[model samples]
Target chain A: MTDGFVTASGVSRHFTPSLPLGERIVAAFGGAVERRSVRAVDQVDLSLRKGEALGLVGESGCGKTTLGRMIAGILPPSDGALAIAGEPVMTCGASPRKTTTRVQMVFQDPFASLDPRMRIGDALAEGPIHHGLVSKAGAVAYVRDWLGQVGLEPDYVSRYPHQFSGGQRQRVAIARALAMRPDVLVCDEPVASLDVSIQAQIINLFLKLRRELDLTLLFISHDLGVVRHLCDRVAIMYLGRIVEEGPTHEVYADPRHPYTQALLDSVPKLVLEEGAEVRFKPIQGELPSPLAPPPGCHFHLRCPFAAERCAVERPTLRPVATGRRAACHFAKTDLNIITGSSSSPAVIASGAKQSS
Target chain B: MIDRASPLARFFGEFRESRAAVFGLVVVGLMIGLALLAPLITPQDPYDLASLTLRDARRPPGYVGTAGFTHWLGTDAQGRDLLSAILYGLRISIQMGLVAGAIGLVLGASVGTTAAYLGGRVEAFVMRLIDLQLSFPAILLAFVIAALLGQGKWQLVAALVAAQYAYFARTAHGAAAAERHKDYVEAALSTPLPARRVVFRHILPNALPPLIVVATVQIASAISLEATLSFLGVGLPPTEPSLGMLIANGFPYMLSGRYWISIYPGVALIILIFAVNLVGDQIRDQLNPRLRR
Candidate 1:
């Protein structure tokens, strides 16, 4: 594969659950103990060209945030390599440490993201001043400039995080990340906790910042509409694996994987016809425990079109269409059409687009 | 208008809204002021052996002594004026509590927060040590240390710090551990700021409200513990009378007809501890974010 500016090849993160106190003592005394691993991000190949916004979409526990953290260099992958501009972001070892200052992350909850005791100016200047990007004397003006860029007033500097409204705090968080002058931004559900109107405002701010800064973005969210609006390319993750990836327009218009289709199908649709009943069909079953994921295809148990072969054999992500890749046994054949599964609003939307 | 005020001014403003807290603050201030001004305000120097006469000893309240001085609270067995001795004792008690509590707060908070921030084995080791210290009754631990170190003002303060630091460490560890998972700490970690800065500047400040509450309460307890050790005759010596040592000196006189000697100093210790506790309670209420309107 061509090396994108930020390249992640087979990156994975696993968490081993510590034994209970009694069991730990037993294990310490040379007795056997069971330890289970949660495969948060299984081997996933992905890359982002410089200045491109890649939206990572998944269900709540599917590890989109984990992937974003790994890309941001805040979290080290348990396996595989992640690099920014050919420099490894983290050292691979038992105790992995992030090696780069080129990537930064803006977290989801603004109320929790900025230090409560910190003044807005200090919170914004902390990174720049520490990294020697700005002198202490210059940090005030530097902080003020970034705050203004994020649409906050320069005078709001001295106010603590609690003094600001949620939207204002989110703006501060964004300004703080940008103040670090990082080349890549991994925004882990940045606007997911905002009010709807505020979400639009922040999204627009992100759009403006991305254009002006030429920032590489790994935008992680479960919100499809926001992802479609902000991202140039989109990757759909399921149970720690990317099931489909393509240009945002193409993937939204023509998703190949069953998992991606189910996700797209779940998006609430507008039905304005008089007396027309709106249908609400959620995906069946719980996400199987990551501790002991099923053999072969992880999604096979929950898959509506799971065949015998799908239950016994795993599918690797491969080219399915122009600029699109999907991991499925029959990516070329459009399974929804073959199986005559529940009619997807996504397909109907695509049909409308083709006709128009 | 309130938003425009400086933080210190705003804190005081909010602090003033609690009448009980203000009252507590005033009483604590009076006690501290009286303690500091003991030598200047009191008529007799309680430690001046040349002045004290056993002939006037055990005098009832408001007796005219041979020295031509008014014994309002009477005198102890050594003929030391009860009021003068208490003021001196208050100074020693307050000084010891503040010194011990402040030192312990710094040491314990640093250790606990660092352990919590590091997590895993380091946290387990530090926390176990804290637990071990805490399992011993605070007074008992102080007694052992005071006995081992011998009776002196600074030695007593050292004992109190050793006995009291575990509480601070436990509180700090709990608060810092909870705060370690907060998004702000994670955001700090993502920055190139050193790990120490992340632990102290980012996590510690957020963890401090509870620690402040703990500090105030611990200071009050420190004063009480010193009193207990002295009452048991293991604390400050007679030459250096803390409230505890004063009470100890008068305990033998309590069985006799003269109640003024012991009762007056007992009252003083109660009033001091009460004032400290009231102030601590007010501080806890004011510092709690939930209690703020």
Candidate 2:
């Protein structure tokens, strides 16, 4: 009971893609055929207390969606453990039927998420009907209520998904998820595919739902501004690991991890400090392929403050403050040092030279 | 706030783009009408053994022969009314196409969706079998099946279905496999809903449009396959006078001067199959988002 309603400890998802036929045949014949396993979610720990809105922010392929999916029970973790409401969430078809109803997910793409053949009413009513919360006779009224909860008109219930706009369809998806009456709602970039104007509306809807429903929200997004606006706490992910996590405002005001600082810096804003000489730009280097993640710290290759020890020793998440954790060797000291010297490239180059 | 267009509006808009589809619709509608009204429209029961005679056999069109207007399209060398025979044939052709299509569609869709949803060895086994079936041309497979069953109504339909269901299954598998991983399907499975319910209710419905278009096309092919088997003398008995039987019965006389015997029924079969194909193509094109323009 002390832990959050949903707890994921060292949960990971790895996929071993099969080779094509020609390559398979060659491999079968003993010819060399390389096989790579993608560690999509690598030993990530997350916890969500009831009625808490925790935003998971990361670049694409950093396993934000994968982590969300694992939480929602759509996918099983490759290793480690997860518990919902102190009951272990079983992977590989072992969880009871009731376990599925306890957590639900809202997907990113509304266009592809809903069945085009299904009427909106059926989509909304399916969960309640399946869960035996309502009979067929009562499903209509129940679905209407859920539809209203998602801000959709109950009159538009009979329409197909293709008949609705993307935003409307997303509302239906939310209603569909909410219909299960889940304690935890894992929204995997639900507003990423929406328009900027529409994104705000959906975010506001989520905020309102959080207030009214008192649901635990594991909101995954790359949008830092949206995360700051909607989340009470935010976890920054880099290469399938939570590099830093803290209260949203505190994290925004001062991100301890270099990766989090770089991510926050990338957000475009209208305001600028008058006569400011220092400006923030996106971090250098592409996100390395998950198949062959760099040794030690995943972000060590891209980190500006990479000293000799940073390349060889992988940093574990450690407590930096009362309710915050960061997985950097120098999370507290890096920002002060970077600010003190606007031209800090020479120090980083010299460190790398010394390490080599 | 994008205004929602009704499904009917979109369908009609797509239909208007293809004139051949409209023509096909008319022809198919006429054939269906002919099937339903076969008993009322036919001058004599082609199935009635006592009605056929040698005297009215092979008479040319507009004949002042024994049957008069009954020999309007000329006799099929059995003295059976050609128009009556054609009408009866429509009934059988339409029934065979629909029944076989339905059977094949249901079986194939179920199997395909199962294979796709439950991947791994299930997919491998089912898909390899579909591949094996696909390796042989559909006609050869149908010919072998019909050859085994000999000649009858249900027998012919069964053979055609056995030969045809694989393609429908393949179509369903391809579409269902694509739809299987979709987030909504995952979301449905994540509910208290059973895997079977999710597979059928959510996954299957999304997978059906392509299967539906394929079913229409399959019906046309099934009819053609039935006729081909009949023409080869293994489909229906001459007693049935299916369009293929009529064509086969009259095929020998085409060497002589009497061309109307086989020519008329042949034309009917062509029109029937071609019209169905046209409808299928139009529906497929309409369903395909890539071809929407």
Candidate 3:
């Protein structure tokens, strides 16, 4: 494994179910009920290269957000090792203050992410001032500058978060994260809650900030189309495990795992050709609960080409091609292929690439 | 140069629109004014021994006595003008209420914030202490403390403060705990701020509004407790003549045709408590935006 800027090796997080009143009453009869554990993220190893955007795509219940939180130091990894810039992140008694300054997270709901009571200026200055990145007056200037950088007017700084639109609040949240001057910015579905038109604006703003500030990004989203446009590399997560990982173009062009292929087929694409009707098929069945994830390859139950071996033996992530990785047994074989006759440039360009 | 059209101004504008709140404010303002102007507004000094005459004692309202003009509210058993005694008593009651409320607010806020910020054992310990204090009735707890310390203004104030601080602490602790989970507080923590600054400056301001409402309501409760303690003969000595003492001294003569003795001071106490409660209600209405709508 090369020394990428941010790395998580076999990281896992488990949450114990808190004993409710009913559970406590049941336990009083000398019968102990086993507490359930939710394996949010399991045995995941990946590296985010410096100054590159990594998109982590998964369904709602998948551990993409949990993995993002682990990287951001909001939730510590329950097992395995994590490092930033070759420095270890997960340790028994490490200072969280130091780790938090290195990486910041922009949450899914911009409104929920920002404090309603705080003014935009105070919200932006809080991180910078606390981190000793700047003096009080200097932090004010930094806040104004970052607000400007995020396409918000400097004059809007004095206003409260509720006074701003949803997109503007997200921009303020971005400004707050930037105030700390972190090396990596983990965006946990930053634009998932925004309007379609506003999503583009926020995405463009993120791209602009990433380029200008030389910031590494871990962008998590369920929307593959948004991920395809913004990320340099994409990782498809299913049932708390990354089913496939590759460069954005390669992964979307030729998704090795059946789950990845299904995800790609599910995204609605615009057919520019006259008289061409593009058919969209949504993924079948509901997501399995994290508490009792299936044995062997977690996706085996949902995979179209699941063999007996897939149900019995868990497949580890292995190199399928150059800069491409997949956890399926039949990586070489294109088991499931859904083709459309649209000559859209995106599809043509992506189809030729074959590795993300 | 504050903005006259700012959101705070708009909030106040909305506050004034509430008839209950406005009426409450007016009543509180008048009571506070009466307390402040006790000396200038009243002709007779409540505490002066020479001015008091037993000959005019327990006179009814509007009765003209031999000693100058009799008060419309008449006199108490001590011949102290009921109106003058009330004005003076209001001054003492207001002073004790404000002091005890301030002490409770400070002590409770500090303890509550510390407990909420440093959870686990500390939270359990502090919350248990609150529970212990709450389990015993507030007036009973005040009586116990007053008995232990002996009777004095400070003793009564101390008892009232102890009784009230627990409520403030519980409210502040809950508010601080809620604020602690908010993003702004986490954002502050992620910065280089020392834990104290994060807890005090950033977390405290946001947590205080709810506590402010609690404090306002507690002020009325504390005053009532003080009056109760005094009425029971464990608070302010006879010479001091607080509203509670006056009410206590006049209660025996209620059926003896001297209705003015108890009625005047009772009305004054009720008015003061009512005014304070009204103001507290207004504060609750104003501070909570959810209530306004």
**Residue pairs whose backbone atoms clash in candidate 2:** none
Candidate 3, residue A139: Cα displacement in angstroms equals 3.3
- Measured by lDDT, the strongest candidate is 1
Kindly report the docking quality category of candidate 3. Answer: acceptable
State TM-scores per candidate: 0.93, 0.92, 0.90
Q: Write the per-residue lDDT of candidate 1 for residues B99-169, one digit (tens) a residue.
A: 99999999999999999999989999989988988999998889999999998888898999999999988
- Tens digit per residue, CA lDDT, model 2, A65-161: 8888878877778887788888765545544343557888899999988877788898888888877878999999898888888888888888888
lDDT of each: 0.86, 0.84, 0.81
Worst 10 residues of 1 chain B by lDDT: B1-10
Residue ranges of candidate 2 with Cα displaced over 4 Å: A26-34, A90-98, A333-356, B1-3, B67-70
Candidate 2 CAPRI category: medium
Cα distance off (Å), candidate 3, residue A50: 1.3
Better of 1 and 2 by lDDT: 1
Chain A TM-scores, per candidate, are: 0.91, 0.89, 0.89
Order the candidates by lDDT, highest first: 1, 2, 3
- Of the candidates numbered 1 and 3, which has the greater DockQ value? 1
TM-score of chain B of each: 0.95, 0.95, 0.95
